[model samples]
Target: MRPPAQNPPTPQTPDPATAAGAPEPRTSPDTPDAHEPPDGEEAQVIVVGAGPAGASTAVHLARAGVDVLLLEKSRFPRDKVCGDGLTPRGVHQLLRMGVDIDGPGWMRSRGMRWVCAGRQVTIDWPDLGRYPDFGLTRSRHDFDDILARHAEASGARLRLGVKATGPVTDRAGRITGVTATGPDGRPVTYRAPLVVAAEGASARTAIAMGLERDPRRALATAARRYYRSPELSKDEYLELWADLRCARTGRDLPGYGWIFPLGDGRVNVGLGALPHRDHGTIDLRATLDQWLARLPRHWGLNEQNADSPLRSAALPMGFNRHPQYSRGLLLVGDSAGMISPWSGEGIAQAMEAAEVAAEAVVLALTRPDGPRRDQALQRYPAEIRRRWGRYYRLGNTAGDLVFSRFGYRPILNGQVMSRPGLLASLARLLTHLMEDPPRDTADHVLNTLVKAVPLRGR
Candidate 1:
């Protein structure tokens, strides 16, 4: 998932930690007109938070000749607690953003290795013309920096060390911009015609705009720590352990654990759980410690080799937040709760939503501020929900059933893992990697089934 707002360590060595903020900016009572901003003082779009969603949005908007302001609470080369695994879907987004994946520091992955119920299987990424048939892993410290710099180079005005406090609204309660606390610890106000909330799962700006998260939706918590594991560092497959159990109750967790090799003597070890309403309390940190202890000693995952502290954050699943576009404010990335429920992946969704939101904004800006512009802006959420709604609904149902009592074991037993065809199908389904018109019979059937599902609350 996208890392929550946190300050990282020195650029040379990235470390993840929580964040701090200051008071809101005060508006002048006798300023010029309320409608007009000072000369050269406003942007066409204000993007809060510089993670994948914000960076992607700013990059696309700048490429389209839109003046964008990208604000971040942290500087470049900062660490964001993440699994660091980029699937083919995410890779496609990076490639579209012109990121050099073949360059140094990018660890390529061949496929995925599943370990559960005393069964193991390796499934390679599908070979499809629509997507690159490979995955990659790079720490968020480097990953986010690359994206932010890329966006800046594309002409987006990126402001680091600036924390957005809240949205600045007009008399009608429509958001005009955001007031922030700059590096000087003083309040500053930035105005824009449109504001994008890419501020991760905390969703500060969206909440301020009165777009609350839907409590009926599923929410997951994830904890991750880095380790120096030479043995696994060069592995081509992204390893997933599905046999995780709760530390307190011995119940199966509703999520999976991952070991993503970074090809640099380091591996990101983490687990995420999408707990249902009745799902009891499970300590993610203790569960992570328990799982790591069971790994082979030769892997060197002990505390002595730990590269980072145990950092944990919430993964808001599905479209947990509503009305993605509200009163000139748009939600993207974790702010809209766009993380995948089945896979616990946020980068791909964030970037994809950024692209969609950028296009919508561009279209909206083409028209005057009226019903037509509002209609164009409203299409953003509808389009996003149309693309991912049914799939996530299916995932939520499966997670509820599969992560329950003896839920995961039966599915992962040798009986199901033995068949390569079935395993590959399962992989494609879980990762949401498929092309239209179908690559094969499996993809055809899968796409048909997903499309046939009755959609609700579009």
Candidate 2:
């Protein structure tokens, strides 16, 4: 099982909350044009919402000598609901971004420990030449702040406390800039030849730009809180419990719970549930209580030990929002719904998507503003599809055919847990870590399975 997005107070935080925006109703004629805005600020690239996607995009672009503007609605060190665990995939991106992971407040993790049906198995993160061997955990509060600062240090112009309200489009209905609310409560517009919506899941700007979440995709809810668990605070493995059940109905639910150590006198404990058929209406809070009640008593997780309020948020998974690049605006991170449906992992996906978006945006900006530029921009989504589309398609298919009905129960059974090698292989597949060239039986099987799964709407 994938690590749940973590507690609010741990040093390792999950991805920040989805950006704030409502579903678009309709475009207003009063919208600002791309070329004409009173007192408009300008940049070659304007990125809205400086979380992982926005900040990572800025870091990559600015390092490439492109002018970039990164805007954020909140100040540094603010809290965001997240699971604080970072798999090796995420660690790879943080290294690419030049984040100093060896520094303080970064707790390293070796692998995952799965608990289900009175059976438990621990698997270490696979060692590969392409990625790090270990994972990390840092609360979203500090995690986002670090990325924003890294972007700024890399030469991205950061404007904090600025919330982008909508995209500024030309008469052709092509986005050319963003209109945002300034820190001083003034309306402002920032123009650019290209714009990136790196904001999280709200997807308001995407909707305003005529994109919408595909109803066919999956959406899940994650709730987390930090508890002062001295015994588990420095544990090396992220623990996932697949034995979740509905407290009232006494029926096993198709979901998982997690306890990730923060190494700072606390552990980020959380649970996430995909959309289920029969148990869709389970009370998450009550379910959490029930799950916690069953853990080892020595861990000392109790109401008084809770360090932060238990908060829940939505994770838009499996590319629910599509057409990642449209009308001069490129959707990055949660804005494009890049979270993995299988593991509920978004940090690695978001940062990685930021890298992909940066590559496309850099190339698109090099070409003249015309069909060629549009074509270059279009490669953003196409390349993303080429890289992870098949895996995600397989995940969504499994979600529809299996998880929606059984949740993690089937996978967490005694048979699957009895074989450690199989469990390790499953982890590799779930996290998209299998070798690309099919070096082993597991790799070949996973690759074939992915290839056989039809792409959605194919």
Candidate 3:
């Protein structure tokens, strides 16, 4: 008989001093007591938000020797409501950023398994033969702190407890900097040649800058919790439960429920739904509990196990169809709706966008008054669209279909599970297509498939 599963780690309250390695909170250069710059001064780039996207961008840019100022509305080690599941791409990006996620506390993962309608299927992520696994799991609280610390170490100046109130624009209507409210409640002005908006779903910065998102495209709410379950210790697969009939609606929403094991017997379990008034209104906690009640006996969870209080938030889906960059400004991650409409996964996309934006910012700074700046800024939105547009659009359409009453069954059995090879092929195609200056025959085939995929009505 198999040995009893190991108990997962208990959820602990976050301690910034211990986690972030800083005793005193860092202050922004715009703080009241900040040293005055000699008459004329400017920051090369100012990134708003200190979450994954913002911190990632700042780190990348600062590593390139560019002066970057990063502002966060909250202090470090703050909790971010999210699913907390990092895909292979997110892992790859973190490595590229010089983050050592596998050190001691991280929970590694290998693949994802889908369980729905009494059927189960698993997809093994492509192994380049070097990496240990496909992904890992960690709370946003610890993850964000790690990223922010990395940014600071790389030369980016981080300012916690500071909020950007509004953008500063030049006479030509181009963004010049931002006016922020510091922890002391005083308004301070920071001048930067370019600004990156990495704030999450609220998109306060983007909206303030006149970017409009299509409402219909925005669908999906998410709730999550960290649970101590001895049953998850040996479970390597990131499990997704697709049946929502167990909940109040008697019908599943466009999205599915997920259980991402964080190793050490802990797991991050959450549920998300595409926008439906009735479905959205359903009590998420009740639904989650209903699902949790049915877990297999071996997958250990009990009343005695310590579990963190549930956290919930809205997920902006179908928001990637539009350009996210404008003159003197760029948006990355959820601010730009970079979350995959199909998977509701944004961490990897956020990091990728951060890298892309960092490259553009570095190039733009070298030619402040030249056409190169304009060209660099212009390339950002277009490049992002080209890179993920087709897949994202298709994902939205697929999400719509999966959530609909009539379309769910066929998608589950016919497209996703029955044809695993097709799914693998698509994944490979997408990976190939996203490479710069697309390859030869593979690029042609991938482009054709992308075009052939129906993206209109579900």
Writing each residue's lDDT as its tens digit, candidate 2 over 1-458 gives: 11112111112111111122323323443343464335456788889988888999999999988888898889997898899889999999999988999999999999999988789899999887788889999999899999999999999889998888877665445666777888887888777767898779787778777678888775788899999998899999999988777779777665688999999989999988786654557677888998889878889888989999999988888888877876677899899989898888998999999999999988877776677787788788889998898898888877776666667878768988999999988889878887778767888888888888765551
List candidate 3 stretches off by more than 4 Å. 1-42, 128-133, 276-280, 297-306, 320-322, 404-409, 414-448, 451-458
Task: State how far residue 216 of model 3 sits from its true place (Å).
Answer: 2.9
C-alpha RMSD by candidate, in order? 8.5, 8.5, 12.4
Candidate 1 structure quality by residue, lDDT tens digits, 232-318 = 999999999888887878888778889999999999999888776687777898888888889889989899999999898998777
- The C-alpha TM-scores of every prediction are 0.90, 0.92, 0.82
> Best to worst by TM-score, what's the order?
2, 1, 3
Full-model lDDT, candidate 2: 0.82
Q: Residue 2 error for model 3, in Å? A: 62
- Candidate 1 stretches with Cα past 4 Å from truth are 1-40, 404-407
Q: After superposition, how far is residue 219 of candidate 1 from its true place, in Å?
A: 1.3
For model 1, give the 10-residue run with minimal summed lDDT. Answer: 10-19
> Least accurate stretch of 10 residues (summed lDDT) in model 3?
1-10
**Cα lDDT tens digits for candidate 3, 320-415:** 423466646788988888877766788888898899889887777676343457677767766776667667776666666555332234556545
